[model samples]
Target: MKPSLHAKIHLWIMALIILVGLGLIAQGGYMQAKAHFAQFLIERAFEQTLVDNQPHKPWSWADTHPVAKMRLLQHNAQGGQQPLGQDLYVLAGASGRNLAFGPSLMLAGAGVGEQGNMIIAGHRDSHFMRLQYVNVGDMIELYSATGQLQVYQITATQVVHETATEVLDQTESSKLTLITCYPFDQLAGNAEYRYIVEATPLV
Candidate 1:
């Protein structure tokens, strides 16, 4: 049977709409799955495992403890080549973005209770967008299989140059330094400045 040109055009439009609908569905599904996987990883990293009323071995960064992976909290500035699911130490701020040179190895360092500063870097985008939201007295917590470590408010924010080593200076107190891209508006490439958020142990 010969169909009119209008019928053929309508059929093509219907097919195009169907394909677009399918694409949207697939994209939604993928995003949902990724979110679920990220949550799972965070939970697993924070999971509690006990041994003889103490704690399991794999939870800490001592004696071959498995590295705890981190996930960006969406809107994170640091873009990763891998999706949020792959088990890698997710950078939370500039350090996470500058994985090669910055504090990407923080997880492998002293877990939480050691002396000296514990610096962590993540992108301004996804990981530490909350930096601006952080108030002077707010509390930040880091979790691992062993237990959760709480850090109290110290300095909520600062700005430094990319060439400034003072931001990474050694501190007597157990500190956590989070770095991220600065000026927030420059999205083309790496910026010349950085934003730092430093916190101290509660006690």
Candidate 2:
């Protein structure tokens, strides 16, 4: 049976729409899978850094590597009991690709455990997602390649514009600064503000 011209055209349009929908789904799935794989590799490299006591790349061809390990401890309201959280890999630089996988230390700032302000940044979606749960008086521990562990207690959190530089100010005393995009739940292509977590060395 020969179909009418309009009928055939309608079927063709439907098929085209279906094909486009399928393609979008496939691309979304692939991106999601890739993101997960990247995170896994980043974590593996971080573990390698700890095991080797130095910077370690996730893959031979990768340009970024893990420079330190960070752990967080949250205490109860009573401040009597402390609950430890996951260990995160701290990478060397905050390039987009680096933050896509894990947290990164600002190369322009002092290194972890140094005598100046040490700035670190991570994606609010992944590595620093839990930062929202961090409270004043919480403890953060950073371990350097030389097996030196520096402990910092959270002092305050600030919400500031992305261009704010005061958070990275140099100081004589050692300080740890963690930065992430503000409004943790909002997913935007460009974030205009930042959530800054400040900590001071624990005596």
- Local distance difference test scores for all models: 0.53, 0.85
**Candidate 1: stretches off by over 4 Å:** 1-25, 48-110
Encode model 2's per-residue lDDT on 47-82: one tens digit a residue. 666676777778788788878878988988785636
Clashing pairs for predicted structure model 2, backbone only:
none
lDDT of 1: 0.53
**What's the lDDT for residue 10 in model 1?**
97
Per-candidate TM equals 0.57, 0.81
- In terms of lDDT, model 2 sits at 0.85
Which segments of candidate 2 are over 4 A away from where they belong? Answer: 1-19, 76-85
- For residue 155, model 2's alpha carbon misses the true position, in angstroms, by 0.5
- Per-residue lDDT tens digits for candidate 1, residues 10-52, read 9999999999999999998997786556445433433433122
Scored by TM-score, the top model is 2
